[model samples]
Target: MGNILNSVILESILLDEGETLYKQNEASAYDLADDNGYAYHKVAAWVKGKDGTKYIKTASIASRAQLGKVNVSVTGKGAAGLYEIDSEFYTVGENVPDPESIRNNSYCYSEVNNVLVSNAIYRSGFANLDFRLSTGLPLKQYFNNDGELNEATIQKVKNSLKPLAKTAVSENPPIMREHLIYAESLSAFVDWMVDENGEMVNKVSNGVLVVDVGGGTTDISFINSANEIYMPGSDTVKTGVLDVFKKLKQYLSSAYEIDEEHIRVDMLDKALRTNKFTVRGESKDCEGLCNKAKQHVAKRLNNFIDELVTTTLDHIIFVGGGAEALREQLL
Candidate 1:
């Protein structure tokens, strides 16, 4: 039996509610389910296969158990017997077993014995192929650095994306190179938009400005009427959304003259839930502290935007995690 293992790294924030989220989640989860009928249909479409021939069987297995049961919904002839399966799942957490360790022979045979037994169907003496459609192995495993994804790493990831094929193996060349090119261009555009000095570049011929603000970096780029795009630079700053909480901590410490480490989680939770930073004790600086943090964030965003607009001639388009949150301040 041949088995294919496909994996995708999804951001938690992207899973927020609504139709877009549902569709994305479903698409990602569908790759792990057994779709023998679907595969046969595809074969039938492309070739003159025999009516009863069992050409291919596709199955999707998720690495995370918390995603819940796998629901196989079939239409046409296969719809009558669709069912669910409680498959074995695994994830790499703070202290969890490393996925690369298994493939690299770093893991002891005994350590993965349970995983092997539980996923025997996948481990059986057949072609065991690992598929990363969008990126290479986890970012941490691919890069030796400690920080998040960088421009160079993004480029590497774009280059590593596999093509859409029934089966993929390390030895096989990518089935579609265009997908890689598209992904690379998109990633490059994003990287150019967030780089601190990216605005210095002239412009692309398309005449569209791109701005990207991510957790670890911000990039700005401009495309001119001549269809030439240019990037001045990017900012690799530590001031992300998470920094807001850190700034809140510092603000509380200075205003209340209290040890931030001793602050209760409940208080922090309340602040986040209410969207209002509050202190229990009689501290007149509580409001001021909150304002200061907000001001700092606003200042950084303003500076980045000011530089980006001043250096470019194209209309602005913002994309990224931080950009979404700063929409109010941006206007």
Candidate 2:
């Protein structure tokens, strides 16, 4: 139990709604810049008779750093239909474009757990160590129609993560000893208050609202005095950081005549925060489009908060990857 608690409390992996993976206090996950599905097919067609090694070295299609080790696979479609499948050695990116997509897929689950394992090993100072994972679900999924935690949903999530328990990779592999999950409201509250010494960082016993603005959804929770979490009034917003990326992707695609697949969510996300981004080997200014998207998201989220929260709240704290990005707008 102590080991499990240490793993759960010492580190955390946040699988944000945008399909972005994050490891706490260590390396933040990055996406594969290449579209891999379509872009690879287009690039593979032109490199048919050319030297494969030379093409990978000189091609401006994808940077070596972005794609990592490239793998080319060929498949027969039908009579006289030969198709090439170009992909990275490992998985990256959202694999699908839908903003409402669920994280039930293997790609999403593996990446998230892999980060957890990596962090656990680092914290333990051992190359191979067991870990207990702690994650959270949105408020809507926390309970069933009976107002009880839906065991079925929790078990389904555990089953989905079973494959990542003992992941075997080229580098130091981690063995997941156990896994646990709690309501995200609790997770948010714990993440904010707990410090490195496992002591409460803030003495705010007053009602505080925690707004976790993530990629696809914004989860709001209120922690009141006496360290109690009141979740009946908690809510989730459908629009988040990814919505901004989609809008920016559409704007850039139409403005520059670039393919929609060429724009990645991470790139546009960086641009929104940094005000500069790269597309098709060229750096571009995206401040205007990014600002427009940010302003719109802020307005929509503000409307939700105005309706839900009350004047009794002492502090409204923002957390999560997109929290900082949307902070200025919210304020």
- The per-model lDDT (C-alpha) reads 0.35, 0.49
Candidate 2, residue 175: the lDDT equals 41
Cα deviation in Å at residue 276, candidate 2? 1.7
Q: What lDDT tens digits, residue by residue, belong to model 2 across residues 175-244?
A: 4556566665455577577874679877655687888776567778767687765666567777676666
lDDT of 1 by residue, 1-331 (tens): 0112322222111121221111123223211211111001010011112343322232222221112222222432221111112232332111121222222212212222222212322321121223211211222222234434445544543433222111111232223212111211234454544654445453444456555544333444455555444344323333443444457777777766778876543344335335555456542425455556656775786676676555534456665444654555553
> Cα RMSD (Å) per model?
15.1, 14.4
- Give the 10-residue window scoring lowest on summed lDDT in candidate 2: 38-47
TM-score of each prediction: 0.39, 0.60
lDDT assessment of candidate 2: 0.49
